[model samples]
Target: MDIGSEYLKIVIKRFKEAKVTAEKAIEQLTESELFWAPNEESNSVAIIVKHMSGNMVSRWTDFLITDGEKPFRNRDDEFMGDIQTKEQMMELWEIGWNTFLNGLKSIEEEQLLKTITIRNEPHSVMQAIERQMYHYSYHIGQIIYVAKFLKSSDWKTLTIPRKK
Candidate 1:
């Protein structure tokens, strides 16, 4: 495979890995725990999921032709703790990943150098992909941290145990 193809595959694999890691952490939490926030300023897991989903849909839908920040996206509303159930949260999570993964899969090797706009800011396709990769990874870390904090003694290590 060419370098572009290899790069795409790696990006997909990394994203899938991040998604699974977050899901594993989420599976350990109760529905109420998913909405728990340490402070008024902090976001709950549900809110984070909602925001990610919104971002994915806005950024990935018609990714090449349209701006990454869609006109219809209400980024501010995503932060509201409105996800009523774990099921709802999971549904949003799946939608976001599906949009992102499908969008990534659709890219051709030649498109990697093409410029795209996010909020009217120009970025090469590679740069845009890396941006989302970092963004999602950051949020997934937050989810894992919050889950660990909530689970405390009951938390199962997502990675190898500290001593093992």
Candidate 2:
């Protein structure tokens, strides 16, 4: 088997699937619901979206040429939930996802073995991609959870509905 090609295909497929699930979950939330939190320490969907967008844009913007943690990123502010509306959140989300997907598409099979840095920690390109994939998926799960909690019985499932 062509391992590199198979790996690339699998990563791309998983990224697309994750994005679809997150978007579907977001669709069930209204503007108010997007910013609701269960407690002071908990994150709202808006905050999670902000953090994910910030992380994606920072990590992927100059992905191969520089460290994944961009100097200009204000990581702390991402949790503040300052995004005033769903439109703002969606715009940021689209920008971040586009940056990430485009960056991923630009990688060549040979480049996967090249080393990259995130917060000065060295990682292969494949490792970095995998890291972000897991990170984004984790936060997306949180977004779905918060949205579902806010929507209560009205929440729509992003995947196959439970068979009762």
Candidate 3:
């Protein structure tokens, strides 16, 4: 079976757009700013990316053969802001992005129809894509929002809508 290139293309495009947003947000941040959590219970952007990496790697690596939520995912520690440096956070993002993109590039048409189990719940491959897209975009929005708050007057607008 063949997963049509068109569908994969759309999914990849959305994912890339989110990556662009994340990069822009990070670029606006200083090293000290990355560690600033709004409150004691909140996470910084660094913490979010670390969690994203954990989610992506577990959910995508050997994706079809393994459970989406891996035994290795430390869901509780994600809020710890464990990635204390810019280098480490970016490296985690790279790892997650590479793993996810590679998996998307290889998805088979058969897999698109096959029911895949995520945390014991079954979903078609397309649904999984939708789920992850929403998940990532939600977090991307958080990154952008926090960056803007930190920037205040210095922030540049990122997704200007084109009036048609």
On TM-score, the leading prediction is: 1
Clashes of 2: 0
Q: Residue 148 of candidate 3: its Cα lDDT? A: 89
Model 1 collision count? 0
lDDT winner among the candidates? 1
TM-score of each: 0.98, 0.95, 0.92
Where does the lowest 10-residue lDDT sum fall in candidate 1?
Answer: 1-10
> Ranking by lDDT, best first?
1, 2, 3
Off by over 4 Å in 2: none
lDDT of 2 by residue, 1-164 (tens): 88887898889889989989998889988778888887899888888888888999999988888998998999999988689999999999999899999989888999999999999999999999889888988998898888787778998887778993
Query: How would you encode candidate 1's per-residue C-alpha lDDT over 1-164 as one tens digit per residue?
Result: 69999999999999999999999999999999999999999999999999999999999999999999999999999998888999999999999999999999999989999999999999999999999999999999999999999999999999999989
TM-score, candidate 1, is 0.98
lDDT of 3: 0.85
User: What is candidate 3's lDDT per residue for 1-164, written digit by digit as tens?
Assistant: 33466788888988988898889888999988888888987878898888888888988988787779889887887777667689999999999999998988889766787788789898888898889999988888888889989999888778784472
